[model samples]
Target chain A: MTQPPVIEVNGLMRSYGGGRTLLGREKPVIHAINDVSFQIAEGETLGLVGESGSGKSTTGRAVLHLERPDAGSVRFRGTELSTLGQQGLKPYRKHMQMIFQDPYSALNPRMKVGRFVGEPLVVHGVDSGSSLQDRVAELFKLVGLDPSFMSRYPHEFSGGQRQRINIARAIALQPGFIVADEPITALDVSIQAQIVNLFQDLQDQLGLAYLFIAHDLSMVRYLCQWVAVMLRGRIVEMAPTEQIFADPRHPYTRSLLAAIPVPDPDRVRPDRPPFDVAANVPPREAPLIEVAPDHFVLDHQVQ
Target chain B: MALLEIKNLTVEFDTPGGVVHAVNDLNYSVEAGETLGVVGESGSGKSVHILALLGLLPCPPGRIVSGEAWFDGRNLMALSDRDLRSIRGGEIGMVFQDPMSSLNPVLTVGRQLKEVLTRHTNLTGRALKARMVELLDIVGIPHPEARLSQYPHEFSGGMRQRVMIAIGMACNPRLLIADEATTALDVTVQAQILDLVRQLKHDFGTTVIWITHDMGVVAELADTIQVMYGGRIMERGPVRPVFHDPRSAYTWGLLNSLPDEGARTQRRLYQIPGSPPDMSNPPPGDPFAPRNPFATERCHREVPPLRDVGNMPGHKVAAWYDLPALLAAQSEKEQTP
Candidate 1:
């Protein structure tokens, strides 16, 4: 709490399909992310969880500057990111990286896995020649993949292995922060554990901060120190991992928790009614209110 | 009598690499009004066996090497294409994982529903339209009549899945097979879909074969659980017994791999050591033996027969070594430390 946070985002807003048409007809604007604000400290993971179209991925993209936000500020180590142009933001890009959901499409089909992993190092001008090869090999070992398989194409590896390749590339620059959007979603249940363990290991070893955006709440509880619940382009609740799981204050957060299918057969699934989004529309202007120590819930009432 | 029965079912693919053993010597039966959950990762043959039974698999590359699937006193394997077509959507309805791909993009939701009804039932004109509306309502789609004219792309992912379910339930089929039906949808939407399925089961007493890799989903919905690995059933039993006392190493590993919801401390997940078996050239012995920690020499040498557990009724496991004893000793060692 003493040192400044690694990444601090404030009032981040991004919308699509707005503005007047050529015919002067008004077009409806869809706010993908609105007034999203959070901070991730050094080596801490902030889990952004919600259903599809809730803008968790949009928030992550905006934070990483992959998608330029319309308004607000992204401060990486107290440096303003939203105002920076493409060329100006290049230096900050190395400190932040993103891993996408689908590993198959994220990788190049023709490119060797080694070259793909080392591409970041080459782009950043961190290393070259024999040293680059040695670094890529070290990265492969870090992610629990055999360095020998670096020569093989992506098609030769499985879903879990492909994800490790993506992770290796993401951490190749030794970035201070990473935005892993559903990294374990595509892999099998068994493979999911391995990848999760790798993420934890990498975080511990390198002291990397992560913006883990995913729908799997259980995995979020296991990995993240902080959790943010998103709904309709706004974070409805933000709290510590234990607090979010143990005592969710927001109605939307409680509903999300109730919806999770428990792996235990003996536990009877609660027959709670689905959260009515139409009935309880999250107020656009309402700010987050502190409910408990480090726990914030959106100031909105259920209809 | 069982609603559906399969014996010595084996499926293979004639790939360029080699003959891939997709499903091997599978034998099981689904009782009436019971939900059978088939759990497995990709390429485990959980979906393939169903495709093979329904005669949906493409010939040449994919072939049913040997199998007999009995349904309603007739062997599904012996049925002609015409006969199988009549029974597929009529007696046994199917809902696949991807709703977008399964549904026709060009046709309106109404048209697709009509197509299924026309093929299976004799309801015509107003009656058919009424039936379609009723189907949509049953699946919890709001304002079914207004929504029917909308195209597939017009509906949300969750709504489109409901439409898929409505189509599957159109003919009032005796058995419903949902293969990872809610896998693509978000958890909130998936919960709604699961609720809809649960409602349908309560109303019609429909026998369901729900195939998914999510043990959590299966635990919530299914009466019986069948764990598949490398195209073979590693374990099968009532959901409660199987989950609480998994006899197969693969099943045990899968259960342990999930993050324990009640764990006070965040501990490392118990990962199933190796990747899934390569079907192109699967090991002659137990398919999961290589990855299994407690695997013995016998397990690596020869395949174990699916045998009934000593005390648990209807519970069966395919394994060479005694898993319960091994787990007991392993736990005791950890506890002492």
Candidate 2:
């Protein structure tokens, strides 16, 4: 007997166009995600993190075919997603869904919350009538939304509430894996915890796997068991959470961890790394590098 | 004496939803050469308290109801607008979150930097231009001479922040109010900005009041921590005890809920339940009582004042329970397989 991994991305690649250099030749292509590979066992959350150009978001989108990959393959539940035809992939979308960071743009302003969530099921021909409404209420209840507020528009809810609606819609089809992209960054600090806890509760109850993409190291550390650090479209480091923090072998990882301002004054390092521009030279290239066990460093490598 | 001492601060705002209490009876002080980190979730009033220092918040919707913002022995709160303006940069500088928005899109970086120097230092013409280049270079903006003519958008997010820091230091003010200064930057750049702020504080002996919701920042830069909730001080003390053995349940939940590398074993974030109280209708008891696990009848019926836990050296926490024991319990819970 065998159980399939929830989601698997192997050797995925993508790029953006580059501006011309001073020498009047085309600049090196931007590697959004290059040869990235990872897996999330069923019900596990794998965190993706990095700076602005790190390509973690691109990888998530590429895995879902929201953004096409330049090369490589993505498999979900042993079915080759990259090889699936456009028509073939539509049905599989029921098993995978994505949640975006911006709650304001993610929801349909014109449609009410009930209709918005039920749209997917209606299109998929899953349910209609009282059963659909019941399912919508169930979905709302499942995501901790008040069923009474089903008819309300997205504007009636706060940022946190809107994100809950987004989650309800994502899970409407009972997807096994979800890519939650920065779902709480725009939320209030106090409200962020509620949403995070809700995500946690949902994962436990449904056995859902999450590719939690975010930049907050502290938050990611809490939600994800295995984390993959990306920089310029390359997976710089991938590891179990404890080892990465306890012994961050990569210099970038060390610097990232060290920079977390410890709130404890007594714990404040008496000596701090000097802030010198000499450190952080605009990468003469890209993809810092693989240095140790499940850790990668991006010092300088273009694509 | 402390360089800045704020006592009895009570700022109010006449929002459409009635008089909103923003900062309520805030009392804290920063030494001449020390950093104070004012931490809280949004609407906890830390930002208002800091902004009230400079009289920056608009008067129509916001008003300082009562307070003594004594900086170097002068009452900044009661000072006239003109008087406050005179001291805003001449004695104290302010930097805010969102460098993208805080910076003027049309203005050149050099112009903004030089304006501060000219306003405070009585410099002009070539002397001022030279000073601007010098200031840019000092802030680690490479090739300051060539870069001076470039507009704000031309620079990267991190570089723009450095420029803002240079402008803040232009007057060499005794204090800098960095309200979420590095929240917009990435981790690498955030470190750089934090390091830069610390270095500037060290080099110039400038007192810093960093107002942010980020716990990591409170951990990294604060010598002292003040946790705010419901427009009042929930706890105030040195940073170590606040993180290690916080008495306030709100503070405890905040620390636990924050994700970090060490917490991979925990499948989910230990987020504090419920929403922050509506300020207009703040509960009579502990603001965090609704969400707090250890809250009791007293916690629900009456507010817990900032009671001195007085356990660790120089540590102070405000809570009804034996928080030290709670912290031990938390540690044990986290340690379990």
Candidate 3:
């Protein structure tokens, strides 16, 4: 536990569209992410879960520096990245990569599979010529894909296979950390297991840290050791996966857990209050209080 | 008589890849007021079967190869387009996956509801206006009168879906077909819509056909479940027995792959080994045999027929393996140190 964190984010904040409108009136600003802070240790998976518009995706992007935040600092391997210029941040880009939810739109359609996977290495000036082909083949094999299909286009592959390609691209640079945003949501049940397992295997083999952002609790629990529940751009609860599932403190977290339809017909879920009731309540000014060992809950008094 | 009955229904789509055998020899029935949940992944032919029943499949590329769809003592397949039109919106209601695309964007919510009311009923003038407001209120939309004047774009995603539900249930149809109606909404909003559907079913005794890929949603809402894979019904039975004691290996795989929130087991998920078969040219034998770990020689040679599982009434599975032998083998495997 004494090892330094792989990525550290402190008091991160981001907003969208506060400028004047075409009618010369001021437009309303949407605080997409507010005062978010988290740490991902080396070779660990940290899950950020929330529904649409909860800013979970924004938090993932902000940490990876894909979308710059308006305030706060992102420290990667003890190096502050928030103030780095574009050229200064270039070297750090290879240490982190992102995978998106939709595989169809993520990859360029016109490019061949080998070219797409090798593009990262080419850009980084790490491998070239015959070595690039070898590296692409190696990546394809690592992700459980057939290396012979390098010449095929993305259209020829199914949804799950396309996701594997996305994973291969994310790891092509051998980054120490990766941010996966809803990586398996678009896949089928059988294929989801394949991708999720591949992620675990890759993480162990490469000693990679992951920031897994998703909306499904079951998948998050399966893949992550620690989970942070976000609501309306704020972290309401942060705990180990077991504690979050077994003993959720926040009312919003409890309702979110209850809303998950368990796949057992004999056990019907007891009705709970609508989640918005808790979301509509104002946030407490108090800081996150540790209720149990390493389990933090937002100190908001519920009505 | 059952509200709707289908036997040996088959549909094919002439795609560039070849003729896709979408629905093959599908047989199922829904009672007057019961809810039937159809579960399947994409390209499993669940949606196509419903579209075929409603006569919505385009003719050139899509053809009802052969089948008899009996609804209210009438063979729906034999009915003319003119007859099917009335049956579609009058006796049968449908809600689709995307609420935004289903509703007319430019039309005020009231006009759309009034059009359906006018087409299927004798109400007119103030009576029509009053009925429209009542329909909106029944679906749990706030400020019903104000919502009626607003366009579809003015409402949120959940509200638009509620409007779609109101339009579908406007005539109090005997059967309601909802195809992934809540897949687009957030979990909280999905729960609300689900609760609303359950209430409507109780109040009006409306038969519901809810099709989705999520087994959790099916478990929460359906009284009976029909699992479809590769254009065929793998298993169909009462929800409780199907979950407790599955007869089909495919169903077992589907259940095992699902990550349960209740118990966090320290084991790898039981994944179905391969992808779903290409439907354009389906294999000669059972479509699931390639991926099924428990597949037998018979499964690779011939298609399994739906038969009753042991003494459980109304439970059927299209599998060659006996349930007792599979269960015994499974327990033996588990017991091994």
Candidate 4:
């Protein structure tokens, strides 16, 4: 608990489609992510959950500096990432990597799986010749993929295997942090468990922190240590995984949790009135009020 | 007689790689007004069988080798293209997975609704316009009259799905087949669509064949559950029975593999060891035998017939080994440790 956090985000803001047009006509601004803040300690996972257009993915992208935030600071190991230009941020890119949702499209069809996995290492100029191949093979083995099949194209591998290839590529440089945006969402149910297990295994072995962004709350509850609930580009609730599931305070959080369809047939799901987002819009400057130890909820009452 | 009965249905696809046995001897029946949920991973032939029945599967590659799909005393498989077209949107409606691709981008929502109504019914002009608006209203779309003129791209993802559902319900079809209908939507939006479908069933007594990979969704919406794997029915029974006590190892493994509320306590989820079966060259005996931990010697050599479970009525499974007994023993071993 006392260890320095791996990544810390503060008052992060990012918007799209704003500003005056050529004719001086005003363009409506859409805040993809607004005033988002969170921290991920060493080897700890922070589950970011929300419905579509809630900016969960944008927050992840902003944290990794893949999409630069319009405002606020992203400190990766106490180094501010927002201020650093592309050339300056090159060194830090290896320490923080991202795994996207679609396994099919994330991988290049033309490239061999071995070269794809080893691409990061090659870019970073870490290893060469037989060593790079050996590293890629080791990475593949770590993700529970057969090292011999590295020569095959992306089409030859299954969905689960393709994801493992992506993971192998992401972790080829042994990054301290990973932003896995809906990593398991695209795979089959049986394969999802395998990938989750792999994520856990990798984290344990390498002591990697993760910003696991997904809509599947059950998986989030199982894998993540902390959970953050986002609604309309703002985090309405932030708490420990157990607290977020068991004692959600925000109406949006409660509605989000209640919406998850339980696997059991006998259990009667309570009829919860849907949270009307249009009616109750969380203000832009709403402060995150601490309700419990390490648990925070946005103060919706403060107009 | 059941409302719709499928017997010995086998579907194949001819490809350069090999002949893909998409659906292997699939046999099942759906009673009138009952919700039958078809659960399976991709390439399990859950969608293909329905497509074949509707005569939607493309020729040259997809071939329905053998089967008889009897719907309302008529063999749907043997029906002519003209007859099938009349039955498709008239007597039997279908809601596909992707609303965006399924809907026409250029046409207004009202036009799309009118197209279905006009093809199936004798409604004209004002009556057709009124029916379109009513259908949209039934699907819980706000400002139906104003919304009708809007295009597919103009609507949100959830609203677009609602429009698709409205189109499916336009003909007042006795049977509705929704293939992974809510899989693409957000959870809250999915919940709303599920409620809308349930409401439709309640009001009109519509029989539904809900196809999806999510067991949770099946548990919530379906009265009966049919678990499919490797293009074969692994298990079928009432929702409670199949979920609580599955006879097939594949079904058991699938239910256990999900990271449900119970799974939260455990350090790791119970993974069903290997990948899904390759349909092109499936194993000789049981397709799921490779991943099934409790597969017997007989399972590796001969395909098990889908037979009724001894104790449970209406419950059927295709497996050689006694799954319940094996699971009991496995649990007992873990308990002792």
Please report, in order, the local distance difference test score of every candidate based on alpha carbons: 0.92, 0.80, 0.88, 0.90
Please identify which of the two predictions, 1 or 3, would achieve the higher TM-score against the true structure: 1
Candidate 1, CAPRI quality class derived from DockQ = medium
Runs in model 2 with CA error above 4 Å?
A1-3, A17-31, A82-86, A109-111, A155-158, A246-249, A268-303, B125-127, B259-269, B311-337
Kindly list the interface RMSD, in angstroms, of each predicted candidate in the order they appear. 1.1, 2.4, 1.4, 1.4
Query: Best candidate per lDDT, number?
Result: 1
Tens-digit lDDT track of model 2 for A193-298: 7898888888888989999998888777777778777655677667777667776655556666766665455564534344333454334335435555655445
* Model 3 regions lying over 4 Å from their true place: A1-3, A277-286, B330-337
Ordered list by lDDT, greatest first: 1, 4, 3, 2
**lDDT (0-100) at residue A238 of candidate 4?**
94
For residue A278, model 3's alpha carbon misses the true position, in angstroms, by 8.9
DockQ for every prediction shown:
0.77, 0.53, 0.67, 0.71
Flag regions of model 4 displaced more than 4 Å.
Answer: A19-26, A301-303, B335-337
Candidate 3 lDDT tens digits, A1-303: 345699999989999989998999999898898888888899999999877778999999999888999998999999999999999999999999999999999999999999999999999999999989999999999999999989999999989999999999999999999999999889877688888888889988999999998877788888898999888888878888888889998888888887877788888577766656533542635468789998888887432
Q: lDDT per residue, candidate 4, B1-337, as tens digits?
A: 4889999999999999999999999999999999999998877899999998888998769999999999999999999999999998888999998999999999999889989999999999898888999999999898999999999999989899999999888999999999988888889888888889999999999999999999999999999999998889989999999999889987887888778683268778788787877799999998888887898889999999888994678899999888889989998999996
Score candidate 4 by TM-score against the native: 0.97
- Model 1 lDDT per residue over B112-203, tens place: 99999999999998999999999999888889999999999999899999999999999999999999999998888889888888888999
Write the number of the candidate with greater DockQ, choosing between 1 and 3.
1
lDDT of 3 by residue, B1-337 (tens): 5899999999999989999999999999998888999988877899999999899989879999999999999999999999998888788999999989999999999999998899899999999999999998988887998899999999888889999999999999999999999987777778888888898899999999999888889999999999998999999999988988888888888888877665567456667787777899787777888888788899999999989895568899999987658879889999996
